[model samples]
Target: MTENTVESVRRALDLLRELNRQRVSSVRHLHHATGLPKPTIVRMLDTFAALGYVVNDRRQGGYQVTSLVRSLSAGFHGDPLVVEAARPWAIAFTRKFQWPVAVAVLDRDAVAVRFSTIPDSPVSPFHVTINNRLKLMSRALGRAYIAFCPPNERNLLLRMLAMSDDPEDEAARDRDAALTLLAMVRRAGFADRSATVEPKSSSTIAVPVMLGRKVLATVGVTYFTSAIPKAEAIARYVPLLKEMAKNIQTSVVLLEQGGAPNDGAH
Candidate 1:
């Protein structure tokens, strides 16, 4: 491709990615998210709409992607970009430490595990499937994300959690306590849960994966509480977990910059 053609393709992909992230986004939102000029974004969105890859919603005052975009990943695996980026490192960490690790991202009011090494971990005693969802206010993964995410996003997530009907989300209703917990997580630079959300014998330490000032996801390591004390676990495993998280963040950023293969390349 010519130089201008390559640049155009990159910009188009960036716009498409921003749309995918937001689901429904206005030109202003696209401009902000992709750092593209408003006129350029409008033109690209119009082109995408004409090509049936996106739909312009006059009523909603935004643009939404169409199923045509799914064709781009028709043969792809289920994991998202962050999961793909973190998979090798997560598995390696588990292999080295004999402790299962999970990579999770915020999904609405809860955190969703996008990648996990538990099932395949060499040392995992139980043959258990990964839990896809965890409460935002009570789980280490969720708290790590909430604590590290930008203030506007953290506030929005808190509001969503507070509106949840689940009794466990009552912590979201206690603004002071919730804030205090998040403050601690931020100060400590990691979140810990001991027999709170998991089995009595299990505990977890989670840290956020950051891209710039924004948290892209959380990486966590889980172990049997009886096997390792909380202080020892924090001291021994937290650095490794944070390192893996940082590496994953770097991989994701490079992938976003077109340094790696597309999600479906696998």
Candidate 2:
């Protein structure tokens, strides 16, 4: 609205802000949210799609922001590459399995959910989980991250958690027992969400996204306990989730090198 400010630029930013606010958006929603004209919003969304910052996914029900927006948005501080690498694969996994997939990265004493496919999942356990921070020992995503990261880094994280008062980090108090529990996760090749977390009727299984033993992030799928037995969910979903994590790793490398991701990873 300023005399020197370009109207188009301001409008575009407004559109982008609205797009980023919603997990998925359409022209109608953008217009309603930003008070922008429908035609203008459509044009901007099309431009975003052509520029690879937005993807129109019918299954997800609208145009969703792609990881390319990480540079444009200053909210999330985790590794953008990991989020970029996991976005498509996570969506694919959710679409195929009908169970929501989430990607998280280490954030201080905990792991933060950076991306989730709940919008694509018809049977998602939670309405939305993005930005939810999970403890490094109790939640599946957090346990996978700490259990798979290097020993030095894990120890540092544990020490940090030990000094914290968050109830979720209570497991860090018993270092010996905590290490023993994490050792089991390492051996089991995945982490299962502790039954103590909210929504006890639902559980998550997570695996680390590793590039040569250096964990880039964690990916998980949540399912209802009543719908699937513990043994069946673990036996069937674990392998696929692990494979998706590996595919994300490969895609991360490729993306960093300015190449298209390997889409045949399913």
Clashing pairs in 1: none
Considering every candidate listed, which one attains the maximal TM-score?
Answer: 2
1-266 per-residue lDDT for model 2 (tens digits): 66798898888887876676557776777778789888888888899899999999888778888989877768856557889879999999888899998999888889999988876777663656678898998899999999999999989999999999988889999999999999999999999998787878899999999988798999999999999999999999999998998889888888777765544653
Worst 10 residues of 1 by lDDT: 122-131
What TM-score against the true fold does each predicted structure earn?
0.66, 0.70
TM-score quality measure for candidate 1? 0.66
The TM-score between candidate 2 and the true structure equals: 0.70
Clashes of each: 0, 0
Task: Report residue 242 deviation for candidate 1 (angstroms).
Answer: 0.7
